[model samples]
Target chain A: MIRAVLALARSDLFRWHRSPALVAATLIPALSMGVMVVALTYAVGRQPVALVIEDHGPVADHIIQIIRESDGFFLVERTREEALADMKAQRVAAVITIPAGFEDRVGSHDAKLDVFINNVDLDFSDDVRRSINEAVVEVDAPSLATLGENDLPPGTVSGIPNPYRIDVAERDLRTPDVSFLAYQMVPVLALLSLTAGALVTALAIAGEREVGALRLVRLSPVPRTAVVAGRLLGGTVASGALLSAVVLAATLTDVLSPPAGRWPLLMLLLLVTAVGSVGLGVLVGLLTRRVTTTAMLGVNVATASFLLGGGFTTIAFLPDFVQGVARAFPTYYAVEGVREVLFYDSMPTLGRNLAALTATAVVSLVVGSVALARVSARPH
Target chain B: MSSWWRAFDGGLRTQLRSFLRTPMTAFLVLILPINLLLLLSLFALTGYNAPTALVMGEDTAAARSYVEALEDTHNSFELRPMDLATAQDQLKRARLVAILEIPPGFEAGVQAGHTVPVNLTLDNVNLDMAEDVRRAVPAAAVIFAARNAFPEVRIEADLRNLLPRDTGYVQYLGVSAVALAACIAGAVLGGTVTAREWELGTARLSQLAPGGAAAVLAGRLAAAAVAGVVASSVTALIVWFGYSVHPVHPLEVGLTLVATVFACTMLGGLVGAGLRRVMPVAPLLIGTLLPFYLDSGALEPQRFDGEWLFALAHLSPTYYSVGVMEHAYHGLVVTPEPRWLLLLALVAIGLASLAALPRVARR
Candidate 1:
């Protein structure tokens, strides 16, 4: 049985090597995802934003000086027309225009300040708006007591003086920034492992039917269970190895933390997932009975799994019902397990997630095996 | 001309029947778009809840006074008597945008009429919410004082900046319909029918027919093109009837639909014939569709900035589809310029390549 499994796994690897199209199909998503992770991380980490000032007056200069004094913003432009053009082109994030006599009006306390920002950016637009508000917050307010003190005498302040002031307080309860790559890796690796497992199984089963090798396998002295088990074992090894390589590469590159404390348990959980996925592939292959259909079904399954697992967006933002539907999907557990290892830096929750993943894998494998056995037993 | 008409009719009938035959395929074609629209509608509904604010305080009367004042206002606040650790956790969960803290003044500043410093701690990561909180706090502070002063001093300033600007519902729905165009075209043009013919060794059947393979391929192309148009239009009408959003210009809509059908039909033919399998075709289609949907300016494009990202988005047929659809929904004139012509040319090239696939056939 071991020899049979080894032979099947070797043959599958050889097929993967020879088929450029299959290799390309599998690698395309991985490459794109890698690129996106890098691009977004870079964008978030260091965004170059210029504040273009249109006013040439001292007030404008003071405002620009204030902005320059602040840490996040860069005063990159001067002149309103140039700023507006740059803003439309997205070269500059915000433009602050101080209308003429702005300081004079503020001195008299009669004029209001107006600010404009291109709302295309939810992040940067809000940043500029806040900076402006903070500037206003820092400005000293002229009270009636101060006015009275200036108008009458310093000791002449009388009547029930206002005895109230607002006290603002804030608290932040947040997890540290988890690497977007690590966050994304959970779903990516799960999808990759499941897809590879399902594809290899489907291809092996469908290829036998297409090339008339199934009859040969059936006629051999080998028991049907041995043949099925060997094929599933081969698929399980291939998928488990594929995911292991990705996790290892990520660890070496510092994209993922090395598995710790319970590496063997993680491996066992991954193997279970692989076996279940193989069974699923075999069931789909048997039902479809066509290589093309098997491939299409495989792609559909992979894409739907990724979407349902909340790969591209946070699950918290999705509707409550969608979140419920997502929890029922197998990829959800796989993703959770991966995230536990990569982000939370914990082993216990990893065990729980892996246990759930193993349960799902076992259930799928049983249903798949039964379906495949029934289909194969039917007389041609 | 005669062959083209025959091709169109046969293609329409064959495509429709094929779509109806496979319920999953039909679901892929019809339901995915509706599902996305429904999802967007769901976002439009529950998304209107007032923005969330975070209020923090120590166990003091000043803290009590601040919380009461905030609660008296119209905004929603997640009030918590927390230490620094819990405050940090609340920020990560995004349950609180800004934290308001009152120091141990013991009511002395109010009695002395001194300007008391009220410190506001905000998650600088979310700049918008910080801005909103900054604006609301001062106003709420003023209003709270006014409630004790003359009741007539309760002049609420209509804060327009606190809310997002209106980018009409029709414009939003238009983007989804255009995105669905790519997926629908992919299913109709690239899926089982073309792949099955290739796999069954029956592509040779068409290749050996009259006018050689090109004529048969042209017929399929013509059919696929017509099928793409009808499918896109039906989905467009759903947006119109279900959402009561009309295209800005009927002519622009017609031209845009025609261009999109051509582009998708050609993409389907080329990808289907080149891959010669439904599985590869589906992934390729989905892989291409994903990024296009994300960057279509439907929700947020300003989040990420890269010339290459924008360049890739420019190549997507959905981008042009969205542009023309937006223009149509706004009652603007849709002109078929050089860019449109170029897209049409690409579609033609795709059809020719698919027609020539017999030469590229493996074994």
Candidate 2:
């Protein structure tokens, strides 16, 4: 039985090696994920804002300096007319204008700075608002001294040195802040393994069925269970090899870190994920019976799994209902587990995630084997 | 003229009949775009609500008031009251965006006219959301300080939005979603319809039957373009009426949609002719469209991102399509000379289509 399984698995691998298009199809998710990560790095944060400084006062210059020094605003110095035109053209997200005599009115408590924002996306506009507010606070209430000093009348709030001043200090939980690209790349790795395993397995079996080789196999003495196990093993090996190369490349490129001491656990999780994916692929192959249809089904299933499994965005950020829906996909557990082991250095729900993946693998394998046996039993 | 008309009519009818015969064709043509739009919109709607935990170590009147102050500040944080241990666990798992820890003696220090520092422990995995939390915390503090202490300091900073009204992030993304739908529909339908002929060995029959292959190809292209336009329009209407994203110039948006459909269909036809396989069309279209969507000023102005990205955006038709749609829908000229760029794209794609069709028909 072991010999027959090894022979069948070898043949499956040999057939896949002959088809470059099938290999290319399996690599599509990884390629797309790479492009998305690069694009996302450029897409988020530090929006462009045109700065029109009409005031030459010391305080106004200080405000301008503060805005320049801040990390949130990519400042473009422009004249008022130019700034307005740029804002209208959507070339810049917001326009900040420092009015003339803005410094002179500071002691009188009537200083006002105008901000014209293109509020197409409130998320971005809110960033601009916060940056401006920070600038104001820096100028007016430096070190909490000027919070209540300049504006107080002679005796109203007498000797009450800034009745109340709030100081905010933020600490990041992650030791080294994860870039958006790094954060998204972990799930992309899982997606790669899932897609490759499922696609290769489905296409291998479906291609055999399409060419009438499956009928010959049934006519032979090899059991159907051996054929199914062989195909699944072949697919798992191919997917595991491909994913290992991707991880190695990512580590070399500094896109991801090495697994450190968690390599064994990571390998185990990836192995389980690949087995589950191969089982699904075999079932799809048995159902479709055509290479093209099987490939299409594999692509669709992979895409759906990727989207719902937090491949593109964090699942925690999604709506409650969508998060609930995400729990159904095995890819979610694979991604969640991989991310924890790789980045967080601790597996919080390792048991639950492993159980889900193991169940998926067992169920899919059983159902797929039964279906293959039934199909093989028919007289051809 | 009569021969051309007959060939076009026959080809259109044949293409339509062929497409209707396959249920998968209908699903790809009609259902996929709507699904993508709905999914992408759902994604856009999320991630805006930053989950935060408020830990009140000192439960005093001032602490309670400060908590209330954070709550009242716009959709900044979805606050949950939890102990420090639970907050730490949640933060580690990235379940919460941040934890605003109000240390003991916060109220006492504030009431004694001293500076009370609030520690905000953040999970900076998503920098965009982290920036939101970082800025929001200080803004809320300023509001609290202004109301309590600085009564005479009246700094009236007038905020004038360039648009007539504020557009939510999801609404802004809806315009791009329509373009994405058009791109996918045009590519998948046009590619599949053209490629399936060769895959099923029906191209020879078409070649043997009638007038020049160009005319037949034109007819097929017309049918696919129409399907693309109709499917994308359904998505647009959902975004417009269902999502309350009313375009300022509805007629202009209609015109832009037609142009986008034509351009994308022709492009897809070129790819179909080149690949000449049914199975590769979907994956190829998806892979090609994703990068284009990202670099196409869909999220923000592409030029502002960087010079490298701006250079890449010029190569994608979706960029010009998104630019034209943004202008037509929201009156914001996100790209320079968008109408001219779209016209150039349409002409280029039309020429490319004419060149690629003979190759496909001959195959």
Candidate 3:
């Protein structure tokens, strides 16, 4: 059975050499997502803001220095006229202004900064709000903002704490903060694997079915189950080859850094995801039996499942019922499973997701084979 | 002239009837685009607020006020009261974004003159999320100090929004997805209809017709554009009723959606004629949509990303679509060009692509 499956798989894999468009079709979505990820890095970080410092006092200078030192805001000096014009034109996200206080207001401890922000959306607005709030707090409590940073500023003593009544200290669960782009890259890979594996396998099978080749396979000496198994293996290997390039590029460029010795586990999770996806392809291909329909449906199903399984956001962030629904799909497991191997050290949570993924692969292959056997023994 | 009109009318009617008769084209144009919007909007609905745990170690006036402050930053976190252990466990398993602890001495220290730290144990898996959490804590602190009249907290913010109100992320994305719908409709319907001639060997017939391929191409594009309009309207309605994203400028929204769809259909026609295959067009269009939307002003003004990326953004029809949609939906101008100019540009793009289709069709 294994040998038969291998032969079937090998034939399917080698057939791509005659048809390069098939390979290109499989990689398009994944490559486009890579481009989107690059675009997201621009969207989420370092927004451009114009700073108009009306007050030339020492405190204003200090705050200006803090704003410059702070993360996430792309600050530039702009005149009042230019800043307002830029804000009206949507050239900058926000305009920060310091009133001409003459440093006397600080003695009363009631200084205020006037900021004009273009509140387009919560994602952009919230970043500005949080950042402004952070900048304000750092004036009174710099230590709180610098939770991990050991560098001492010119004015403040290293050991000395601020005299504020309230302070906020945020401790990360993991060291070395992972980039949002990198974290999102995990689910996108799952999306790619699912899309590529399923789309390729389904298209191949459906193409064959169009010419009545699938029913012909049933007349072969090999067990029908082996043929389905071979399809699954072939799809996984083909997509695995393409996704492997992404994984390799990401690793080489330091776009993704999994935990030490976790590369094998990560690859295993990807293979499992592809297998499950390919299995699903077999089912879709068998059911549809049309190349175009399979291709269209494959893209839609993969996208929907990818989003439900937390492509852009955390599954925890999803509603209770939606989260429950997400858990039922292999994509949910694929994402969480990959994150387990990538982010966490212990990974006690990996077992359930792994089991679910493996079950998906097995069930799809079995169902596909059964359907293949049920088809009439005929030739085109 | 009359013959051209006849051929154009005939081409339009035939393709329009195909959408009704053919399952694949209907699925490609109407069902697929709507499904895309629904899935994305649904994801947006549940995915905004991070699920967090609020562990009140000492539930005093200060702690309770702190909770209120945390809650006031409405868009950031959805805090639920729980024990530290449960929160930690959930955080470890990726169920919670963070655990906010008012560690035993919080209220007392806050009531007193000494500084009291509110510990936020965060799952910093995604740095953007971690930044939001980190920033929210300080945001809450600003509220905390102001409410308590903490003297040492000197500087404060007097924020003035340039826009009247901030549009929610879901609404923004939903509106953007309307343009995405147009893009899909254009590519799939436009391409498939144009490519159908070649695939079914009718390109020869169109070539032999009195009006030549131009009239046939226009007829096909117009039919697809109407289908594209139908697809985007359904999406816009979904965005309206489903997500409460009411278009501020109804006339402009309608105009933009129609024009953008028309442009996209022409582009799709170009792609279809260029590829000359029905099989690859749908997947290619669907696959490329994400990057187009991402680089376009769908998330924000593409120019905000950077100059280089902004330059790339103009390459996408969705960028112009975004400018028009952002204005019509949210009442914000993302592009320097006038909306009328942008709309004209979109129409020009469609015409250019339509003109280019015949050249590809000859092959």
Candidate number achieving the greatest lDDT relative to the actual structure:
3
- Give the distance in Å from residue A79's predicted Cα in candidate 1 to where it truly belongs: 2.6
By lDDT rank, best first, the candidates go 3, 2, 1
**DockQ, 0 to 1 scale, candidate 3:** 0.58
Winner by TM-score: 3
Q: Write the per-residue lDDT of candidate 3 for residues A1-380, one digit (tens) a residue.
A: 99999998999998864666576667776667667667676677468888998887777888888888878688878999998887776678899988887367877887889888888876777778878878877776776655435354322333445644655556667777777778888878998898778888888888888777777785688876677678778888887887888889888988788877888888888888888788788788777777667767776777777777777767767667877888888998888889888887568679988899999978876776676556534444
Clashing pairs in 3: none
Ranking by DockQ: 3, 2, 1
Which model is ahead, 1 or 2, in terms of DockQ?
A: 2
Each candidate's lDDT (Cα)?
0.54, 0.74, 0.78
Query: In candidate 3, what are the lDDT values of residues B1-363, reduced to their tens digit?
Result: 598998899889998887787676476557777777766776566434668899989878888888888887737789889998999888888788888878787777776677776667778887777777777777777877778787776788888887788888788888888888878877777877777677777877787768876887788778888888888888888887877877889898899888888888889888888877666777788778778888888777666676787788788788888889888988877887788888888899988987787678776
The CA lDDT at A308 in model 3 is 75
Candidate 3 Cα deviation (angstroms), residue A291? 2.4
Superior by TM-score: candidate 1 or candidate 2: 2
Q: Residue A82 lDDT in model 2?
A: 98
